[model samples]
Target: MINGVTQLEILDFSHNRISNDGAIALAKLISWHKSLQELKLCNNYIGSLGIEGISFALARSPALAHLDLRLNSYVGDEGGIFLCSALSQNTKLKSLFLAACGLGSKAGKFVGEMFKVNSTLLEMDLSNNDLTEESGELLNQGLIKNFKLQKLDLRMTNVSQAWEFAINEQLARNIANSTRNNINSNSQPNMKTIEES
Candidate 1:
C-alpha cells in the first residue's frame, strides 16, 4: 500500500503541484497510517476543499507532530479556520509552518484561539500572511495565556509597530523571569555540601 512500508512516519510531497483530488487521496492515506509523525505539503496548489480533507485526516492522527503547509496560497482564511480547528484537537503536534498560505485576520484569530488551549505546540510560523493589527492583538491575547509556545514567526505580515513593541516587551519579561528563576535555583546550597560542612 505504501511501497512495502506499512507504517510510515514522515511524508514529504512538497512542490508536487497536487491539487484537491490529490490532497483527498493523501488524506485517505494518512487516515490509514497512524504512525505518521511529520507531513509536508508545501508549494502545492491545494485549496479549501483539499485543506478540509487534510484537516479531517489530522483529526485522527495521534502521532503527527510537525506539519508544513507553506506556500499553499489557495487555502485562504476559511481553510486556515478548518486547519486550526483540527489542530486544536491534536495534542501531539509540536511545530506548525503555515507561511504564505493566504491567511488573513480571521485566520489569525482562529490561530489565537488554538494557541489558547493547545499545550503541545512549541513553534509556529505565520509569516507573509495578511494578518493585521487586529490579528496581532488577538494573537497577543493568546500569547498572554500560553507559556508552552517557545517560538513564533510573524515576519512580512501586517502586524503593527505597536504590537511588535508589545510582543518584544512580553518576550523580554519572560526571559527575565526564567533567568531569575535559574539564578535562584543555582544560589540555593546543595544538601550534600551542607551536610559535609
Candidate 2:
C-alpha cells in the first residue's frame, strides 16, 4: 500500500496528529534524500505553503514512484500548480493520488501540461475537485500525444458527461497503445532460443 511519503522508504503520516509546521518541515527534507522513492501526506491539513515547500523539495529529486496527498483540502489551485510544475520534469514517478485536495479548474491547465511531457506516470487520481468541463478538455488535450498514462480518476468533479467520456476513451486508447507496444517489443524471440530450435 502507499503511505504518505516522508522521504523515507515508506513513512506513513496519515492521521498522525502531526502539526502543520512540523509536517511542512519534514516534507522539506525530501530535497536531500536521493533514495527516497515514495511520499504520502494524506489528510494532513497541509496548506499551500506547505505544499510549496514540499513541491520545491520534491523537484530536486530525479525519481520517485508514488505520492499520496489525499484529503488535504486546502492545497488548492496554487498548491496544485506548484506540485505540477515541480513534477513536469520528473519522468520516473508512476502513480499520484490527490483525491479531495481541492484542485479546481485553475489547476487543470498545469495538470494537462504535466501529461504532455511525462512519459512514465501511469495513474492519477483527482476525484472530488470542482473541476469543470473546460478543465477536462484541457487534460484530454494534453493526453493526445501521451501514451504512458493508463488511469485518471475524475469522480465527483463538475466535468461534463461528454468530456468525461472523451477523457476516459483517451485513457483507454493510451493503455491499448502501450500494451501493443510492449507486446511488440517482447515478441522478438531470443537468438539463442532460435538456434536451439
Candidate 3:
C-alpha cells in the first residue's frame, strides 16, 4: 500500500494489527517525502524494534511535527526511552501524544529530561500510564525550566492535584517574571531617553 503513494502527509494507522514489518515499510517512505507532518500509529503492535525504525524516519524528516504512538502494545520504559531520544532531536514537533503506551517509572524520568532541551514542543499527553510521584517530581522540575510548554496532561497516574498546582504556579510565575523584566527594561530605556532630551 505504501509503494504507490507519493504525497502522503498524515498517516494514522493506529488501532491496527500491524507489526515491525509494517512500521519499517512506512519508515522507508520518510526518505521519499520529507514534507510529511503528522504520523499516528496508536494501538498497534509496534514494539521497540518497530519504534527504532520509526525513530530513524523521524530523525530524517525535519518537517514532521505531530507524532501519536499511543497504545502500542510493546511500548514500555525501554521503548519510551528509545522514542524520546528521537523526539529530542525533532525541533519542529509541536504535539506528541504517548498516552497509555506503558511508560514505566524509569522511562518517565528519561522522558522528563527529554523536555529539557526540546523547547519547541507545546502539548504533551502522558496520561493513563504508570508515572509515579518521583517521575512527576522530575517532570515538575523540568516544567520549571521549560518555557515553551503550554499544555501537559499527566492524568490517571500517581500525580496529585498539589503537584499539578505547583507546576502550573511555577509556570505562571515564570511568565510573570519575564513580563516584569521586559517592562523594567523598556521603562529604563525610555527614562534614559527622556533624561537626555
Candidate 4:
C-alpha cells in the first residue's frame, strides 16, 4: 500500500520509530512524485541526516507547500540552518510547521535570518521549541525587517516577558496597519456604480 504508491498527495509517519534512514527513503521519493504536497514526519527518530535529505529534496520540489516536521529529535541548530537554506530557494511553500523540533539559540538565529529574506512564507509554527531569549531577540529583529509574514506561533517556548511585550506591540502595530489598509481600500468605491445608483 505504501511502497507501491508513488503519487501520494500526503504522507504522515509521525510518532514512529523511524530513523534517518527511513526519513531519507521518504525524501528520495519526493523526486518521483510531483503531486506530494503535505508531508508530516513529526516525532520520528530522523535526525540531522534525515533533515538534510529532506532539505535537499525540497530544493527540487516545486509543488510541495506545507511541511510538518514537529517533534523530530535530530534537527538542531545546524539542521535548522540547512532547512532554512533550502527554504530560501523554495518559493512554493507557504506554511511550515516545526514545533518542538529541538531548536536552540543557534537554530533560532538562523530561523530569524530566514524570515528576514523569505517573503513567500505566510505562516510558521515554531511552538514548544527550546528557543531562548537570544533567539527570540533575533527573531524580533527579523520580524521588524520582514513585513510579509502573516502569522508566527511561538507558544510555550519560554519567551521572556520583555520579548513578549515587544512582540505584543508589534502585533498591535500590525493590526493597526492592516485595519488602516482595509479601511482605505473599502472607502474607495467604483465611480460607475455610484453613478448608476
Candidate 5:
C-alpha cells in the first residue's frame, strides 16, 4: 500500500497493530525513501526482532530526524539495546520517544553509552518503563557526559524521584549552556569600528 507513494517526510502509524512483519516492511520503506524525516509507529505490536531492522535503517537514514515507538511493550530491553547501539552513530535524529517499551537496567547501560557519543539528540522520553535505581544511576552518569540534551522525561517509571529530579536539572543546565553558546557565537565583534578607531 505504501509503494506508489514516495518522498514522504512524515509518516505516523501510531495506535495501530503493526507487528514485527509490518515493522520490517516499514523499515524497508524508510530505507528506500531517503526523504523521510519523521516516523511514528507508537502503540503497535512491534518486538525486538522488528526493531532490529528499524534500527539498522535509521542508523543509515540521512533525513530521518524524529522517531516515536512508544507503547510497544514487546520492544523490551533487547530491542532497546538494538536501537540505542545503532542510533549512537546517528547524527540527524533530534527527538525520540520510547515510553513504556519495557526497558530495564540493561537497556539503561546502552542508553548511557548512546548519550556518551550522540551529540545531536535534544529531546527524549523514556517514561513509564522498568527503569529502576540502577538504571537511574546509569542514566545520571550518561547525562553527565552529554551536553546537548535539553529535555528528558522519565515520569511514571520505576526511577526514583530523586534521580529524575537530578536528570531534569542536568537537562536544564544543558539548555542554559546551549543558549549561552548561541549568544556568544552570534555576538560578533564589530571589525569596522575597530578599524575606524
Candidate 6:
C-alpha cells in the first residue's frame, strides 16, 4: 500500500543506508507493484538475509527488467548465488549490476550457470569483485552459449586479460555475423526486383 502509487515503474534508492529491514520492506513493495521495471539499491547496507528476501520477491516480479545492487559489500558469495538462482526464474530481467558486492569465484560460477538459461539479460556489471581466472573460464563457457548479452563490465576483477580478449572477440564475431545475415536478407528482395524489371 504505497498510497495511490500502484504503477510505479522505477525505484532508485542508491546511496541510502537501508539495512536488512529496509530491504525487506522494499521487497514487499516490489512484489505489490506489477509495473516496476527497475530497482536500484546501490551503496546500501543490505546483507545476505536482505538479499535472500529481495531475491524471493524478484522471482515473482515478472516486469522487473533492471536490478542494481552495486557496492553492497555485505552481500557476499552466498547472496550472489541466491540472486543468480532467482534470476534464472525471472525472464524479464535485462540488466544486472553487482559491482563491489563481495562476490568471489564460487558466485561467478553460479552467475555463469544463470546465463546459460536466462536468455533476456543483455547487460551485466561485475566490476571490483574477487573473481579469478577460473571464474572467467566458467563465465566464458556461459557466454559462448548466451547470444543475448550485449554489454559486460569486468573492470577491477581478477579475470585475466586473455579471457577478456576472448570474450570481446566472441561478441564482435556474433555482431558481425548478425549484421551479415541482416544485409543478405535485406538485399534479396532488391535483387529480385531488379531482375524482374
Each model's lDDT: 0.85, 0.82, 0.78, 0.79, 0.88, 0.87
If the candidates were sorted by their lDDT against the true structure, best first, what order would they fall in? 5, 6, 1, 2, 4, 3
Q: Is candidate 1 or candidate 4 better by lDDT?
A: 1
The reply for model 2, stretches above 4 Å from the true place, is 1-8, 17-20, 192-197
Give me the displacement of residue 149 in model 3, in angstroms. Answer: 1.3
lDDT of 2 by residue, 68-110 (tens): 8899998899999988988886666788888998899989889
Top-lDDT candidate index: 5
| Each prediction's RMSD to truth | 4.0, 3.6, 5.2, 3.6, 2.5, 3.7
User: What tens-digit string does per-residue lDDT give for candidate 4 at 65-171?
Assistant: 78888888578777788888987777777788888777788888888888778767777888888888887898888778666666778887777878867765665
* TM-score per model over all chains: 0.83, 0.88, 0.81, 0.80, 0.91, 0.87
Using TM-score as the measure, which candidate wins? 5
After superposition, candidate 1 runs with Cα above 4 Å error: 168-197
What digit string (tens of lDDT, one per residue) describes model 5 on residues 1-197? Answer: 66667767899999889899889989888766767889999998999999999999888877888999999999999999999987788888999999999888889889978998899999999998887888887888899999999998888778888888888888999999999999998897888988999
Counted clashes in each candidate structure: 0, 3, 0, 1, 0, 0
Task: Score residue 103 of candidate 6 by CA lDDT.
Answer: 95
What's model 4's overall lDDT?
A: 0.79
Between the candidate structures 3 and 5, which one is better when assessed by TM-score? 5
Task: Write candidate 3's Cα lDDT for 1-197 as tens digits.
Answer: 76566676788888786888888887777545766788888888878888788777776665778888888858778778877787678677888888887787887788778878676787888899888888878888777777777678889868777887776776676567668878988777576678899
TM-score, cand. 6:
0.87
Q: Candidate 1 versus the native: TM-score?
A: 0.83
Candidate scoring better on TM-score of 4 and 6? 6
